[model samples]
Target: MGALLRGLVGLILSSVLVTSALAATAPVGGYTVVKAYPHDTAAFTEGLFYRDGFIFESTGLKGRSFIRKWNLETGVSEQERIVDSRYFGEGVVDWKNRLYALTWTDEIGIIYDIDSFERIGEFSYPGEGWALTRDDKRIMMSDGTSFIRFLDPETLKETGRIEVTDHGVPVRNLNELEWVKGELLANVWQTTRIARIDIKTGNVVGWIELAGLLKDAGVTGTQDDVLNGIAYDAVSDRLFVTGKLWPKLYEIKLAPAN
Candidate 1:
C-alpha cells in the first residue's frame, strides 16, 4: 500500500511539471522591436534608469561592479565608479536626490549622492536583492522571487509586499523591474518573456515575448543573456528592453494579440 501511494504522488508531481511546461510554451501575444541600440559588451548591466536627459546604468559581477553615466545619443560612458570586489551590486534607483543601490548577498543597501557617487548611508534588507523600481510614492523591490515589496522612500523600511501569480500559482524567478504607467514590468530569468504584473492584486496581466528580438539580434546564449533589463522614457513614454551582456537594447511597442 505504501509503494502504491508513493507511485501516485510521483504521478501527480510529473503532471504538475508537464502542465507548467505547457503554460510556459504557449504562444505569446504581440510585440515589436522598434529600434535597437548598441550596448557596451563589457557591462553586465544590472540597474538602468533615465534621468535628466541621459541614461544611468550599473553593472554587476564581483571585482567588476560599477555605476556609470551613459550618454544616450553616443552610448559612451562619461563617468563611472567601481564598487569593492566583495560586493556584488544589483538593483539601483534614484530617490529624493540620492541614489540607492542594493547588494547581492550582503543584505545591505547603500545610498549615494546622485552627482558625486559618494556613499551617504546604508540600510538592511531581508533577502538578496534582484531589482528596484519606484512609483513616486514608494520603492519597489524584488529578490529573485515572485514577491515584490514596497519600501518607504525616505527610511528604506518595508511597508508592504505582494506575491505575484498567474491563475493562483506563484510566478517564480522574477527579476529586473521597471514601473511604467501603473504596471510592473518584470524580466523572468532564463525565459524569453517580460511579464507585466499588477501590483495591487498580484495578477500577471500580460507578457511580451522576446523570441523575434533575440533572433534578430543574433543573441546566442544558454542562460545569462536571456531577457533582463527594462527602462521606460517618462517624457516620451517609450519602452526599452535588453539582456545581460546583450549587444543591443531595443525600443519596442506592444500590439494587441491577433
Candidate 2:
C-alpha cells in the first residue's frame, strides 16, 4: 500500500524531470561505516536530523506518516506522534526549539515544541514538500523539484529559491536534505547518491555514492530500500544515514569512491 503511493507520487514528481547526470562537474566519493544503529524498518524515512542527543525523523505515506523522536543509542522512539491521515508527511527540522514538519502534496507544514512535541502552529506553501533542512538564518525546503526554497523562520514565507544544478543541468528528485559542514547534501531519490551542493552557487560540488551499504547491512529488498535519509550530528561531527524499511542506520565516514 505504502509502496504503491510512493510509486504514484514518484511518477507525479518525475513527470517534469531533469537528467541527473553529474558528468565531470562533481567528484564522486565513498564511505566507510563508522558505526551502526537500529532503525525502525517500517519507517518510510522522508526527513531526518540529529538534535541534542536524539534523532528526529518524519515518515510519509498517508495514514502511516509519523514524527519519531528516537534515542540515538538504542534506536528506539522515546516519543512519537502520528500526522493527520489526510496528509502524507515528509521532511522535519528543528529551529529555535521548534520542530517543523512538512506534508507532501498537501502543501502544509506543522510546527511543534521541540521538548514536548506539542503542536504550536501550521503554515501553508505553494507546492509539494519533499524534504527540509536548515542553515543559521533560514529554513531550506525541497518540493520534489530542482529548486530549493528558503523560508524565513518567523514568517514561514519563502524568501528565495536556489535552483540546484550540476554543470547547468537541473538535478531533479532532490529528496531528504541536511546541512553538513557548510554544504547542502541532498538525496537523489531512489539512488545510491547524495549531492553535495553549494548553496551560494547552486552547483553540485561533489557526489557521495554508497552503492553497497544496504547490501552489506543485509538490507536486501526491492527498489523501496533505496538510500533516502541523511542526518548530521554537528557536536559529535558524526554523519548518520538510513533508508526506507531499512533495519540499520549507519554512521559513515566519507572516503574516496573505490
Which number leads on lDDT? 2
Please write out the lDDT profile of model 1 over residues 1-258, one tens digit for every residue. 999999999999999987885475322576777888878777787888878767777778999888888777678887787877899988888997899898888999988898888888899998899889998899999999889999999999999999988766678988888999999988888888877888999888877777787777677646566667888898998888777788887889988643
- Give candidate 2 misplaced runs (Cα > 4 Å): 1-22, 220-222
TM-score of 2: 0.89
**Candidate 1 to truth, TM:** 0.89
Off by over 4 Å in 1: 1-27
Question: Looking at model 2, which ten-residue stretch has the lowest summed lDDT?
Answer: 15-24
Against the reference, the lDDT scores of all candidates come to 0.83, 0.89
* RMSD after Cα superposition, model 2: 9.2
Superposition error at 219 for model 2 (Å): 3.4
